[model samples]
Target chain A: MTTSKSNFSKPLILVTNDDGIDAKGINELIKMIDSLGEILVVAPDSPRSGQSSAISSGYPLRLIPVEKKEDFTSFKTNGTPVDCIKLALNFLCDRRPDLLVSGINHGSNAGVSVVYSGTMGAAIEGAIVGIPSAGFSLCSHNPDANFSACSDIVTFTCRKLLEQGLPQSVCLNINIPASDKINGVKVCRQAHGYWTEEYDRRTDPYGKDYFWLTGQFINLEPDNEETDEWALAHNYISVVPTTYDQSAIKYIDTTRNLFSE
Target chain B: MTTSKSNFSKPLILVTNDDGIDAKGINELIKMIDSLGEILVVAPDSPRSGQSSAISSGYPLRLIPVEKKEDFTSFKTNGTPVDCIKLALNFLCDRRPDLLVSGINHGSNAGVSVVYSGTMGAAIEGAIVGIPSAGFSLCSHNPDANFSACSDIVTFTCRKLLEQGLPQSVCLNINIPASDKINGVKVCRQAHGYWTEEYDRRTDPYGKDYFWLTGQFINLEPDNEETDEWALAHNYISVVPTTYDQSAIKYIDTTRNLFSE
Candidate 1:
């Protein structure tokens, strides 16, 4: 294993994804940004979708080295997305990473899906450690989905982030529409929406009932152009600056009043 | 199974927790609020800590009914805390819950831990469904922790929430100190903090290395009186109004300027 020694010459970039180290999305992302910096990849060994900020406890984690090259190294762990970030930051990285990027996820992490996204969870973990971080996703869930359309946008966004640091405690959730012809990018707010969960019930061989989780996204404000959902629907790449601190500051006083009596 | 028909005669309260169906903290929580409304519990069958807003998608889930009474019914699911909430709201509940409460957690879910809390995840799910919700946590992690001191506070908070509805998409994260005599209650903001992860590495009999996840919280703003950490340290019950919408709205303009070039 390479020692985590500081090399102040070039920027060290930490790359990861929730879709595991072998996914096409992450491979495309690594190739697109190879010129940006020295790369260190630590990701889950298998797809860990919908695991938002979940960390594995009560069990020991194993990190296996997958590949090693000059200026690039890769390892896969038997852990969740957030666990990958923790392992990379705390044990693996050669130094404090200059920038941390997660995903070119297999599906959309737009709207309220951010809360249930392992992609965003890794980025949020990076932000917590004071790293400039961002998560990227395509609207399509196809295993062999074309990510070429997202290459330039991803590179540009990362370049800008490297040039200009993001505010502390903030990370970006970038969702690109699944289109051959792209629209421009827009910085927008997280749209108010939810999954209308419909469980597909079936009986097992033992005559026991089981359910498969399925849902459709319901946009509460479909016409609001300021929302990420609206931006994505109009074929624009949506970027929402998200924070780990979820305090609703505007309602503090109201809550205080409710408790005072 | 009960039908999901609205019964507006009495308030229907949905109760849940991250620490399985049999944890002492949850039992204490359910007992304290029995008089407020009709209670229906849908929780995980086993302890599911640190599962923040995670949902199970690729696998089938099983919900097992454990107990049934006149005004209270309980079911345990083989899923994450957020999944339990989804199942209750969409499949199990006899009606829309007027109020939702998660935990009197064995450990504190204050400060940045809120982002990783399954307790808070369930409450956030409740808030997303427009129900008044709150998650309660004591500062202890002991399996048989004394919870008598938290009884009055839990009852009072639920009563107030039932009386005055929380704003849409907002929920409370109430963390009590371990002290038996609480100083009082303080409504505060989520504190700035991060866990300093220390992985305990060990060599297995097969000559492979593994790591156990462990950490200490490093509070960034230790002196900030407005933060949740400070409130908890002063022996007060910290009530932070948390929102699931994590957009950092103040950074939108700056982010837009970065992309404008």
Candidate 2:
């Protein structure tokens, strides 16, 4: 697993995820990426899935050092994924890491799911801070997902990213399918998608009505091979180049007309 | 304020924000928008300023209906701003809202701040579900900051969005400068920016090291008048058209080359 940098200067790799430090997915990711570089595992102390790019601003945050290993140093925070990244960059890391990787997320963070993804949130934060970053996810919600199938692809993608730098402030959202055997990787765009709301109403012990939030993710163009959703559906590892800039430049003019005085 | 909808059919407007329901900013917003339509306020129980587009998926969420007025309904959720919208759309509102408005936030969410804004998160969630949505912010961070300067602009923009409709899945991030009087509104692009981290480290009574994260928002292109940051600096109400589709379409080939076997 020793690559070019591993021999001369071990690249410092900062790893994080939404599924707390104890989750099996992140441990699997740590085991694989540790071989490539000196690792720093800074992640949330609790599950923060769907936490998006949230930061714990109102209250003072604390970063507790959990463990120190030969190849890796670990810390956990009572914060969101983005918070973990900020803490790692500011207080924990000795220097800016050579690479930042998030996840092996328990569930897929493709399509519209990116908007509420804490896994991609950390990666985006890494990109924001001028670090090369990537977020990996498998298309499985189960805690004990089969990660062996995607390990090679993950290693290859991370190695490729390290070898050939990504565009400035751009990060990668790589999603692998749940199958034991995988097709080759494909570079694709995010599929246009929405989640249909289906709330399950329930009553409390005191007889007050409440609701449980759950939905169905609907891909508008599911058949399009140019999208991440389609690629993942067909068992191909999908790599979508993502940027933090959310400006829809093409629609600025149309939007301007609405606000014209 | 009740121009046409209040008489025949009141348009339902879902109102939410990152700065809890009780924040002075949201109250000011609610007071203004209440006349235009039937308002449903579903905001977080506490402040969630930098919460981005986070959702509470790990635990069972509780949506407690607090107040019900003749033309307005209010609920507080133990969730993020995005959760407020999801709950509102699923259980609170009879149908999808005609318009979704977030904030009149106590501070500016301009430039790169849009990527980490809970106010914008609610708006983006609204847009994701195919609603006309916008997030408004004032340049002041004080809880009691005078929102008087930007109230009219907020009303005008929301009114304009309601009247003319935005592009599909595209929402607006409107940042109002803190000025006694404004120069008027200008639709602008998001300024390319980054936050330089300058963390404050501290130790607890037990003498363990921890840190409090803080940073300065630095505009990479400060001199560009075409950006939201520039527009706000010059006292213009800057409206930046925002979308959730994060795909860096231009860099797809560049990224693909890296993944080639």
Candidate 3:
């Protein structure tokens, strides 16, 4: 683990989220980074989960000012995770951050959820911009999720990154379980899992129809100890060094031959 | 290539999309697959790009009928890409299809766009459900972009999948460049590239300020011919096997070593 460069220059930290400003999780996260460096937040005005890296192609984004404290100015934006990052860099922040941390998301972004996590989308956008970043999420979905256990780990991880510069083209996804105690941090791989979907139909007050989508999660590799799931389940903070490129390098050879003329 | 399955029930081809039923893309796609088999479309009522493999962790999904064309049934749903696949398999479709096809997406889902594409999400969901699937996209953003060139290859690809079943946990991401004279199909890897995001600031008619995000696509590996970008540049349909496991398997050794006490 290489440490982030530490000169006299204060590290510029860009903070954003999928959950809106009122989210207690982000509040707790903000407290942890108070003394680290300068902070600027431009998060979504409302929760935009399962939005992935979606950018508003039709509707324009609206950035509104939110409460700010010393060295911590915040704004709420009507956009997706990707939109928030774009706004932060191109409009809000003068320069890129030493780190861009998203979430402290309301729930787990482990396994397949990571692919669809707005929190992660922001982090990946930061990595795309050549900035070392991470997305942190608690396993609890409660709006007032007790983030007591995650604060120390979050601070430790950020401090570590501030010490050891992260590897290029990679962002970290740190998901902590909903527990009173954390075993420690474990660098692990994304667990293999997916959701089984179901649709419930209903009628509106005006006789118009509406639908709500819901589902249950299924993990294929439940017993894998080297996975993020194992770490999270065992009350440890799981740090998965995630990459944006989803290439199947190992099978490239076998696949190339399959398409050969 | 091998031929379609010789004697079982006519090859069942499941059709779905990220675009709603009214979307010209899905309509064009369904028309293309009209004669392929029993075509059942379970798509969103609106465009859902960048949805990835995210699911509706909310209320039950509502599957609504959109339009009924002769031998083609169209249904609208309030769900994500993964939702459409799960519902089509567990609730809607009578049985798993020999082939599941998603998109002739209105825009390019090439390069790094696959990570955020709801189109590919649907296809990946199909693979997870033990069904062979393929996602097709046209490198055009025009509302009425011509898909006349897509016929021969799509039919041939469908036949190929029906014959030589795709490898497990694999689905094809076929990105067709916007050109009439294509150099045939090229099997390639995803190009390492990203959008250099730029946000456009705007003020609404109301006295309030806001921001709109925009960007230009930049290819990092401009000279790499083994990538999807090169295939697109050469005016060929790039068929890259896109995966979602997103496990940094190669880096596991290094990362695990970092975690060692």
For model 2, how does the per-residue alpha-carbon lDDT over B1-261 read when each residue is reduced to its tens digit?
111123237778888999898899988898888778778788899998899998876667788777645456788999889888887777667766889999989899998899899999999998888899999999999989988887787788778877877888799999988898688888889898888764667778988765666789999999998899999888899999999999999999999888875
Please give the lDDT score at residue A149 for candidate 3: 81
Ranking 1 against 3 by DockQ, winner: 1
> What local distance difference test score does each model get?
0.90, 0.85, 0.76
Residue A61 of model 3, lDDT score:
77
Evaluate fnat for each of the predicted models and list the values in order. 0.87, 0.80, 0.56
**Cα lDDT tens digits for candidate 2, A1-261:** 011123337778889999999998999998888788878888999999988998877767777767545456888898999998887777667666889999989889999999899999999998887888999998998998779877998788778777776888799999989997687889999999898855667788998766666778999999999999999989899999999999999998898777766
Scored by lDDT, model 1 comes in at 0.90
Complex DockQ, candidate 3: 0.49
* Ranking of predictions according to lDDT: 1, 2, 3
Among the numbered candidates, top lDDT falls to 1
Descending-TM-score candidate ranking: 1, 2, 3
Flag regions of model 2 displaced more than 4 Å.
A1-8, A68-70, B1-8, B68-71
DockQ (Cα-based) for each candidate: 0.84, 0.71, 0.49
Error of 2 at B75 (Å): 1.5
For each candidate, what TM-score against the reference?
0.97, 0.94, 0.90
lDDT of 2 at A153: 80
Q: Which ten residues in a row have the lowest lDDT in candidate 3 chain A?
A: A1-10
lDDT (tens digit, per residue) of candidate 1 on A42-129: 9999999999999888589998988555457888999999999898887787678889999999999998899999999999998888
- The 10-residue segment of model 1 chain B with minimum total lDDT is B1-10
Residue pairs in collision within model 1: none
Task: Point out the higher-scoring one by lDDT: 2 or 3.
Answer: 2
Predicted complex 3: CAPRI docking category: acceptable
